[model samples]
Target: MKLLEVKNLIKHFPVKNHKGQVVHAVDDVSFHINEGETLGLVGESGCGKSTCARTIIRIYDPTGGEIIFDGQNLATLSQRELKPIRKNMQMIFQDPYTSLNGRMTVRDIIAEPLIAHKIGNSQKERHEMVAQMLKQVGLNTEHGTRYAHEFSGGQRQRIGIARALILKPKLVICDEPISALDVSIQAQIINLLTEFQQKEKLTYLFIAHDLSVVEYISDHVGVMYLGKLVELSESKELYKNPLHPYTQGLLASIPALDIHAGKITDKAEMSGDLPSPISLPSGCRFCGRCPYAKKICAEAEPPMKEAAPGHMVACYLYS
Candidate 1:
């Protein structure tokens, strides 16, 4: 069963203008995350991956489209009505420093969500729950009394994960959760997340700009460009055989261990500044950078078509 389903999701931020110009942050993107599966949303910075995640969670109310979670539409719910549903969904933000409260101790930070949701009535129960969660994430109960500022970047992220998972949320949106940490610490955080997912049967919508990292953790992957998904496929299939020119370009950029092995003769290199989202190109959003872009690519948007079983790409070259 699908835990979350998003269709034609659109989010636009109004610019500072008397005429009310809007930035098309995320436009008409669609995907789904199945229960107990991790669907990685990968894209370059400013390509709307973060915006899409935020809109689905209603952090920014979507301008249009359907956000269906567990067979119910999230866009239709009022703030008050959405509160209960929020308990079942949680977000682990990118930067631990900004996402956490410096003034609050680790215990208070983790317990706040539990308190807000009224998961446990008594303070004693909350404290016990916090202690257990701290241990679960490789921290001791003693560490809980320390303020977030006292901990290392990795430790602070552990606190963030503990807080997000304390409610046992079914769907966790990890928005570049390890991007701000040290390279050595990235694996530890990823391992912790993997362990927890297996233990709790959690589903994840993992968003990242790093395709390599996304490939390591995701069961399936979606590549986004200028507010649209250009390619999507199983993690192994996508990495082994990326069909779209954009996807191929992204793969080519990744530093491979074997410099000589499995190298494609024609490496696609993308150039030119990303066109402004406010005034997107008429046809393919990637046309400006795609090497194989044709005349039709400048005149008509290509519909996402299946190139092989379970593999899909949006490009006129495929048609």
Candidate 2:
């Protein structure tokens, strides 16, 4: 069952001091996250992965698109109408330090959402809920009295998780949840999230710049480039046999220890800096950097098409 669906999502930020010029952060992106499934969204920096996640959660009002959550069109909802829906959708921000309030105690930070939504009337009830959530994310209940700044990076993230999951949201947008933690702590966070998903059947839109991290937690994976989804498939299938030229290049960039590995010897690498989003390429956004670019690729954009069973690619070569 599809828990959340996004269609043709677009978000453009106007360039400062540049009249009529806008940074195209997200463009014509679409994907669905199933109930109890994780859809990992991966891309390089400035590829619009974060923008996509924020737009879905209404943190950034989309320039244009449809966000359907649990059969309701979020785009059409007024602020009042959205209040209830917001409870079912939550975001776990990428930077735990900035996301948490320094002035508020850990208990108050985690209980804010519940109070905002009027989930509990009394302080005692909210306290109990916060304490239970703290333990669930592997934090001691006593830590709730401490300020967010008092904890380490890993511990701060645990508090963030506790807040995000306190309401038991159906969709959690984990935006690079483990990116800032220590390498050793990363595994613990990943395992905790996986364990929670198994126990609560939680769904996630896991966004990250790291493909390897996405592969570990995702059931399906989508590769984004310049605000567009270039390829999507089952996690293992996408990693093993990427189709788009951009996807292929991204996979090759992954470090390999053995020099004699049977990977693509003449790896396709993107050249030239990414074109300014304010002024994208004429047709395919990636045409300028694509080694396989042809006249048609520069003349017209290619629509996404199924290149293989359960594998979709957006390129003229596949079309």
Candidate 3:
């Protein structure tokens, strides 16, 4: 069953004092995540990865397109209509330090969702629920009485995870949940999320720039560049053979150790910064930085086409 299906989703931020000028944050991107599946969205900073996730979860209202989740079109729903639906979907924001409330105790933070949705009958019951969730996320129940400021970065993140999962949401959008953590702590959080997914039969839309981490957790992976999906395929397939030039560039940039050569192989073959979203290129968004650009690439945008079974790419070379 498809838990979430985003079709031609668009989100644009208007430019200040510039009539008719808008930042194309997300443009006509489409993808889907089946129940109990994970889809990892990857790209450099400001590639609209987070914006896409935010739009789907209704943090920012989409400018256009459909947000179909659990057989309903959320794009058309109003705030009142969406309140009930919001419980089925939750988001783990990027910054753990800011995502949680400093004033609220850990118990109150985890129980907020339950209180909002009216999950428990009394305060004692909700406290018990929060305590259990704390233990599940590897936090001590005694810590629930403490404020978020008192915890370490990893411990704070664990609290955030507990709060997100306390409701047992059907779909969770993890927006770089571990990027701010220490390298050693990243794996523990990832492992915890994976374990929860297996036990709860949860579905996820995991967004991250770490290709290795994405490959490990995602069933399917989508590569975004300049607000467009340049490539998408099964995790192994996409890693083995990245079709889009942007995708290729991203994969090539991943550091690989060469023990025999006695040097770390880290080469970012693609050059040049991203073009201004205010005045985007007439054709492909990545044309300016693409090494394999053709004349037509600057004249017309390439449509996403399936180059092989279950592998999709947006490039004139594929067409």
Backbone clash count, each prediction separately: 0, 0, 0
TM-score of each: 0.97, 0.96, 0.97
lDDT of 2 by residue, 211-295 (tens): 7888899999999999999898999999888889998888778777677885753567766767888888998999988999999
C-alpha lDDT (0 to 100) for residue 72 of candidate 3: 99
Per-residue alpha-carbon lDDT of candidate 3 for residues 47-121, written as tens digits (9 for 90 to 100): 999999999999899999999999999999998999899899998888889999999999999999999999999
lDDT of 2 at 76: 70
Q: Which pairs clash (backbone N, Cα, C closer than 3 Å) in model 3?
A: none
Per-residue lDDT, model 3, residue 85, is: 93
Flag the better candidate by lDDT, 1 or 2: 1
Tens digits of per-residue lDDT, candidate 1, 198-239, equal: 999999999997888899999999999999998989999998
| Ranking of predictions according to lDDT | 3, 1, 2
- The C-alpha lDDT values of all candidates are 0.91, 0.89, 0.93
Give the Cα error of residue 227 in candidate 3, in Å: 0.5
Query: Which stretch of 10 consecutive residues in model 2 shows the poorest summed lDDT?
Result: 262-271
Candidate 2 vs candidate 3, TM-score winner: 3
